[model samples]
Target: MLYDLIILGGGAAGIFAAINAKLTHPTANVLLLEKNAVLLTKVRISGGGRCNVTHACFEPKQLIKNYPRGEKELLGPFHVFGPADTIKWFESKGVLFKTEADGRIFPQTDQSETIIQALLQEAHGLAVLIKLTEHIEILENHASYFTLRTKKEIYQTTNLLLATGSSRQGYQWAEQLGHTIQKPVPSLFTFNVPASSLKHLSGVSIHPVRLQILGTKLFQEGPILITHFGFSGPAILKLSAWGSKYLHEQNYQTRLMINWVALSKEETFVKLQEAKTHFPHKTLLQKNLFDLPKNLWKTFLEILGISYKKRLIEISLQQLKNLAQKLTGDRYQVEGKTTHKQEFVTCGGVTLKEVDFKTMQSKICPRLFFAGEILDIDGITGGFNFQNAWTTGYIAGKSSL
Candidate 1:
């Protein structure tokens, strides 16, 4: 069967594209192909199953900044269909999304299934054909139509949208079509600090802590989690995102400096001195001057070789200075990295320059479109990445006709 529009992925971008394409060209037949049996696997597990649909940021210019790779390219698409459009689109589909304090938007039910069901229902209602476990073995683009061959079937489409995000097969298909692909690498990962003092303090969370990748200007401040493997949290994830390319070049081995107390050295020392003077009889560990978790404070004290039972008054000037220094800048070697939960993202994909953002169509191939992580565009954690999916998918789907 010859389809008017064939989306080569069933992820967020593919599904969104298929729906929009069907809507824009009501008589056009849209088919969505997925290598996996399931559709929207990432959406099912996103945001801890809450499914971050889009970021709360509505401004188009500001929304483009979250993307590290395709910031400039996305600026054009985002202006056309940004976060506000995403919210409206989903809401119109009967899925009410709410934004969190951190600006991540999710359904009011707090279940990823809501978003998945909405997408599935919308696609089904629009008569968008969905075929699962259908892998494209070969793609042949002719002057009039593109032929996609699988083991058992030959499908042809006039408009082909490659929304296959980060899949190796997707890259292979783009390469076959004369598109340059960037080497894919891990992004939004957590550093594995084996000998970190916080290693034993698993389940302890600290907020407003600053993390800096040693030897680089990469820095982020937010909540941090001390896991058994190492550190995982918003701050570390953000740093991992910005430093993904550089750190990948470094072989995942780098030094990380942590500021348990997000305060200047002078300010930290003043607070410590005040604690010593005001609570002379209280033990340094018992006083908890930094508003840090009790276990974390004890771990730092142990690292500093200070007795937790020792009274603050008994601490000498040298020990006080050491504590302050450690609090402001504790360094650890990140020996490796771990996937930051199920929300793993790749930093590289199809080179962005080949695709026209205004229409999301390929410059090399007419009637060929691109969207989602398949492009070299990827955003940081939160809902920025999904917003990329919506913006590009909408443009590709609408303009493909």
Candidate 2:
């Protein structure tokens, strides 16, 4: 088969790119090839099926900061087609989106199928051919056109796009074509702490807690969860992305200091003094009184080995200091690491240095474009990953001619 464009992998980036490409030039023939029976599998599973379409942050610079690793490389991409453009495009398609208080953008209809249907419908209207279950095995880059060898047949196109997110086979394709693949690593995960105080306190969550992998400066906060495995949520996931190397270097056994309460040393110590002064005899586990979760209160008290039974009046000055220390800078051993599969993402692919963000085109291979998680850029949770799909797909579609 011969065409103007051939898009591999019919997920978020590939299909979206196909849709945009045909929209720009309705006469252009675009073929989207997928190895799966369905399209947008990742989009369907994302945000627990609601599909966080994009982040609420419309500013490109502010939006780029959310990505712990490819921020600098992502800046150019965002500045070109960022969050605002994504919202406009979706709204234009009759899918209105609303922002959660946390800044995640979801269709007011609250179904990923709605978003997928939008893409499918748009592509159908634009006459983009979606070839399912076709496995692309090789790419022959001639000076003029690109030939794609699939297990089933030979396909050729003037322009080609690879958006085969996270599949190692796709990485192999990029490497064979002169793209650098950063060693793949897990981007979102939960720390596995042993049977410590934080364990079994699983359901307890702090609204905003500091999570720092000891020996590294990486840290972030916001709704930290005490899971049966260890800890998770935005704070832990962001830190894991930033310090993935350091944590793995320590064999995931690094000590972590958590401030269950988002308080400074001064305020936290004063609060501890107030607790000691007023509820001198209350159990240390007494929670839901002032701070976030009460279970976290007990967990912190237990993690520090400070007996809550000690009478307030019986507590010595140094003991009060110790209590403050435990609450402010509690430390636990991270015995291991496990990707929070529920919100997991792959980091590192098709190194950004080799591709031009302005066009999502390979600097080494002309007429070949790239998009989606197959690139080294993966965003933090909060719809940034999907936004990358939108922006890169939009740009590639525009530049594909």
Candidate 3:
């Protein structure tokens, strides 16, 4: 039987779109296909399984800032169905959400299953047919309807939605249907500094650190975690995301400048001078000034060639200035990148200009819709990526009907 709507992929956007499409037209025949055995895998593992459903940022203008690629394109969509709408939609389905201090919204139970169950239940209630482990091999548009041929069977639908994240097959199908595919690149990854002196402090986390790509205007400020592999944390992830394309162009070989104290060299110098005067008799190692972790400070001292046994008062003016510069403008060479845990986000997909954000319908092909990371839209860590899924899915589903 020819379906009214067929959503490719059982991810967040595809499943959500299937439910919304059924909700839009109660008797419409909708089918969702997934190559994987389970649906919503990403949702199940998001935010360390708590499932960051959406961010707390409510305003459309402010919410778009989180996305490095779809900032301007998402403005209209977010205004239509933003974080507030996501909260209400899930809450109405019996899932309670709580916003953390970092503005990430998660289920009160802190289990991603809560979210998966809600989406599954809604789809089941709406009679949305779901086929798992089914991969479509060919897609042919017949003007009025689309034909999708799987290895085992063939199906047809009047409207097809491609919510296939960053899959290569998804790009192929989109290209077959006449959409321009942007070259996908890794985003939201950690920098790999194999030769870093701070490698020993694997678990050391510093807050309010400023990270910058040495020769570029790209920079981010937040907490950074020193990993055995390299640097991974909010600031590094943000920087990686914003500079994904550039870093990819550079082959991930670039210089990363960091301000550990998030302060100017001059400010750090003054603070150092104050510490010297206040603790004149104490050894530089004894005071542990500047609020940096004791072990990290010691390592810094070692790297700077300053003796820990040296009294603060005995240090010369040049030595103080050197310490200040090191504290505020440390540089490290980034040799590669590591995926941020299980969350691998990409920086490219279908060109944004080719998709209508209002309806998420493809400008090149009628009745063809796109959503999620499959589009050239990605946001930094938080609920922003999922929010994009929900917003675009809702629009596509509603418009498909």
Candidate 4:
């Protein structure tokens, strides 16, 4: 097949790139190749099917900070195109988005189908030829043209964009094409322990936990979940991302210290002291106004070997300190990691050094372009990753003309 531009991967970046390319060169034949039977598999399942469209933080500088992998390198690219533009682009497509308190934006319809339909609709309008079930196994560049060999056919194009993200196959293709790449690592995930406290609390969520890996500078905050196996939630997911290598080095065995209350020990200590002073006659076993789940609080106290039936006035200072330690510095053993639905990410693609961010074009292979998760430019969760898709995809799409 012959085309002006051939985009690999039918996901967010590739599809957006196709449409953007057509907008720049109306007559250019833009072909998008996807291996999956359906395009936007990640999009369909993202945010538990809601599809976090983009984050509310529209500023380029602030938006880039969310990324752990490509923050420094993305600064320049973001200045050219960022979250604000991402929101505007999607809004223009008729898929309205709204932000949550945590800055995660979801389709107002709360269905990922809406966002995918909008992309498919735009691609169709622009005459973008999409070929699903076509997996490109080889990408070779000769002079000013690029050739992509798939399982069934060989595709030739003047401009080529590789948006195949995360897959080692994608990384290999880029390395073969002479691009430096980062060694891929799992980013977002949850921890799995054999007999975790969260085993029975699958859906129990604690919002805004100040969590630290048992012995490191790494810590993160957001909502946390007690899964059937262990702990998950935005807090754990973000921590996993930020400390990917650290966790890997530790073999994921590092204990995680959580401030379940999310408040400083000093603050919580003061509150506890006030409670003890005022409620000296109160039974410790009874429920208190601390707002913690009763079962968890009771279990923690039990570990301290303190009987709940004991009167607050009768508790010794040593026991009081122990209770304080349990509340403010609870620790959990991390046995291993569990991938969060294939982590819905693209990293370790084409290296950043070889791509000109200004044009989203390859430096070594002229007339070849790159965008989205395929270029070692992955953003953190939120609309940041999606924004990368929009920006780089838009640039590659338009520049190919």
Among these predictions, the greatest TM-score belongs to: 3
Tell me how far the alpha carbon of residue 201 in candidate 3 is from the true structure, in angstroms, after superposition. 0.7
Off by over 4 Å in 2: 274-290, 302-311, 340-343
The segments of candidate 3 whose C-alpha lies over 4 angstroms from its true place after superposition are none
Q: Number of clashing pairs, model 4?
A: 2
**lDDT of model 4, residue 89:** 80
Candidate 2 clash pair list: 280-312, 287-294
- Clashing residue pairs, backbone N/CA/C < 3 A, model 3: none
Model 3 TM-score relative to the real fold: 0.98
TM-score of each: 0.96, 0.93, 0.98, 0.93
Superposition error at 188 for model 1 (Å): 0.9
Residue 243 miss distance in model 3 (angstroms) = 0.2
lDDT of candidate model 4 versus the reference: 0.79
**Pairs of residues clashing in candidate 4:** 21-397, 285-308
Cα lDDT listed for each candidate: 0.89, 0.82, 0.92, 0.79
The sequence of per-residue lDDT tens digits that candidate 2 reaches over residues 43-144 is: 888888999999989888899888876789878888888999889988899998888999999999889999999989999988898889998878888888
Q: Which candidate gets the maximum lDDT versus the true structure? A: 3
